[model samples]
Target: MESATLTRPPAGSPAPSGPTARLHVERWPLIGLVLLCAATVFGFFYYPTYPNYDSLYSMLWGRELLHGQPLSFEAYRAPTQHPLAIVFGAVLSLLGQDGDRVLIAITFVSFIVLVAGLYRLASRAFTPAVGLIAAGLLCTRFDFPFLAARGYIDIPFLAMVVWAAALEQEQRRRGTPVFALLALAALMRPEAWLIIGLYFLWCAYPASWSQRITYAAWTAAGPVIWALTDLAVTGDPMFSLTHTSGLAEELGRAKGLSAVPSSTIDFLVRLDKAPVAIIGILGFALAAYLVPRRIWMPTALFLIGLGTFVMVGVAGLSVIQRYLLVPSLMVMVFAAVALGGFTMLEAGRLRTVWAAVAILTVLGGVYYTTTRVNLHVFENELRFRGDSRNALEDLLDNPKVRAGISCGPVSVPNHKQIADVRWLLDLPKSQVIARTDETQVERARRGGVAIYAANRAVLMRTVLIDGMKDPIMTQPLPGFRFVAASDGYGAYVRC
Candidate 1:
């Protein structure tokens, strides 16, 4: 944590002075970038931030945990996501309100930590300029800032990965703290588990037989603990991994092992869309010729891990750009190494190229900050299809609607339908029934003959509910009368 310098001048030499001197020696640029990222996040939250279904699910899970409720939620809660939510929920419980503030705090702190970690890694592995470049580029990489603002589980997990990798050499001197951090990272995302495995594989090459086994054993603790925790939480040892696999299959994202070529192409294409990626790729391409041996293991892990992730589509996961953030950072480190070599070039032409790279990086940073910062406030309005679920909930003031049927219980329905019902109607998993099956539909109908409600979007999306396509309020089933309706929803009364 000492002040990072571009170089250490000779002892007894006059140290540099003034703003230019401070610019070369100080961490202020990194600080400035972090502040910019934080400001952008603040701008995003100035509006009512409503996250996607996963965020809502996490909050609900966390809220239940805070209330001392059992883990009775029907959906699979992955180990990587739930712990953070539970902690967030517990904190929210004490705060009385300000859940949004808590979310923003977690994300902003993680963003800052991630920036700091990247700077440290780049500084140690390459140079202060490289470190500064890497951090600055990350802040500007459009998705990076937004992802942090959204407060997903990835940023915190990535922060741990960055710090662990940065301090990896110190692992030998300081003991097994990096392993502990990696273990925690595994609890955040399964990618760290693979990284740990890959690290141990690299360690095995030069290590003595006993040393190799000890190191492997040390690395095994993370996955082993993860599996044990999964067993304890879900009663299935591999549920987190397996459940994700099944969900991916259901979502039609699973390609088994056959998706390697296309997934790799897709991953690369998506990666290139990030503004910082081109520079990182250029640096990595140059690193192949220059500084080939430096940080070779981390470089290989990034390639192999990413290639395998693309190929196998781990846990049947879809290719998300943010999933590659850690590997991207690795490439950025390699790029920094390349830049370091370029700066040391003997020829004027090569040095000019290095200067251009520096100039491009600085300009990119400015452009990213200037363009991405804007505050757009959206009203906290809840509209399910055309009907304002918010208005209906207020008008009805019915507690039973909390457990009432709206859209089908299964996830095949439009996500907004499920989320709206869960959020506005307060529907619990047990009371919900899948409308996909005639048996479930009949059962739900017979169980409650008084009223029925469903969102039209779900009806439109699924064939099973295609019977409910009337322009006006109309019964999709017999013994039901058209009662009232909203723009996106239809309500019915049983005769």
Candidate 2:
């Protein structure tokens, strides 16, 4: 093989400088990026919106903790508790009625942080172009933004994991900071426990005995705190695990280990869409062939995330789509490489050809999205969430509804609206009942404030169970008389 000796610029004479240098120098400031993200969220996200069921439960639990009450994790259809989220909820609970919106705002910021972290990780692993493309793809994936807008804990958990990956990528074996981020993420999701444990092993190979001990402590922090919290409240160290499994069974979300392979492919396709998934696969193969070192960290993350998801199925936990988010994100990074990897190559005919292919792929993706994606449907769904929340609040605030509350508990069609009602009224778990609960149905029918869906949209979305399994849920109680109505809800009193 022919070889040529490489030499540096002589005596530091006129160091390399041009558009590329200026591009490096004029990087966006973190504060500026945050402000830009804030503006975008403010402009696009719906206002007067409440958190989703899981998040509202967090707020309610936080309020309970603030007022020195036990957490009602056993409440009908309550989601599994997340330690960091509860702490955050406790802080936001101080805001009273405004806490819900503030939680959404914080989630919006978490989404921004997630995007930023993805950009940083991708850029460090690949190039700036790839990083920007990956971040853009993530933003365009509506599921992620929807989760953030609804205040799902997954967004912040994702942010912390991505940032941890970024930090580790910036400097291999970056000890405490990366562990700290992963520890926080662990508090949010059990998946991070596996990640942090693996990371500890990687760090241990190069550390002193004391450093190993510290790393072990950080690795244990998430599960220990979680178990302790569960033990303290529910009197079972394994309450979260056992409770989540039972709830998954009740909700029909448990798919089992046999479904993992198919679920993995299905969820990836759902998150990244078919075209991106295909491109990401191709990109992974190509990067492995040409630049294994650069791709290794993201590849490790992809595998770990996939493994964690499979374990979730094995452990009989909820085998839902959100659990695949981290792997899907890594797929986005690979897909970006398929689009922008040409930038990393030296200027030549091969590079030109690859760049042309990338451009054509972009056009194809844009066409596919334009033809298949319905922006209006997404808009209306988000609008309904905000509108329904406001209407529910209005109904609860009605004079007759308040008077009926004094007479007896407030009852909803099912567990769907239980958290929302409790959060809105600051009512105890016992004070807001689901008609689906056979134990409460008799009491609800006797006397109380019964809330019903006021329109078709609300009826389908809130009152009816999945597949309209119970039509009677929307039927009016015999003795209840209509007292007041709002756009999406109707109030009746039996007192």
Strongest candidate by lDDT: 2
Predicted candidate 1 versus true structure: per-residue lDDT over 147-218, tens digit per residue: 665566678888888787777632332225666677677666667777777677766787788877777776
**Stretches > 4 Å off in candidate 2:** 1-39, 44-48
State each model's CA lDDT, in order. Answer: 0.54, 0.86
Count the clashes in each prediction.
3, 0
Candidate 2 residue pairs in clash (backbone atoms < 3 Å): none
Residue by residue across 196-239, what tens digits does model 2's lDDT show?
Answer: 99999999998999999999999999999999999999999999
List the pairs of residues colliding in candidate 1.
Answer: 386-487, 386-488, 387-488
lDDT minimum window of 10 residues, candidate 1: 377-386
Could you estimate the TM-score for every candidate? Answer: 0.70, 0.94
User: Which regions of candidate 1 are displaced past 4 Å?
Assistant: 1-23, 65-70, 73-101, 169-174, 200-218, 274-278, 307-311, 314-322, 334-349, 357-427, 432-440, 443-495
RMSD of each: 6.9, 3.6
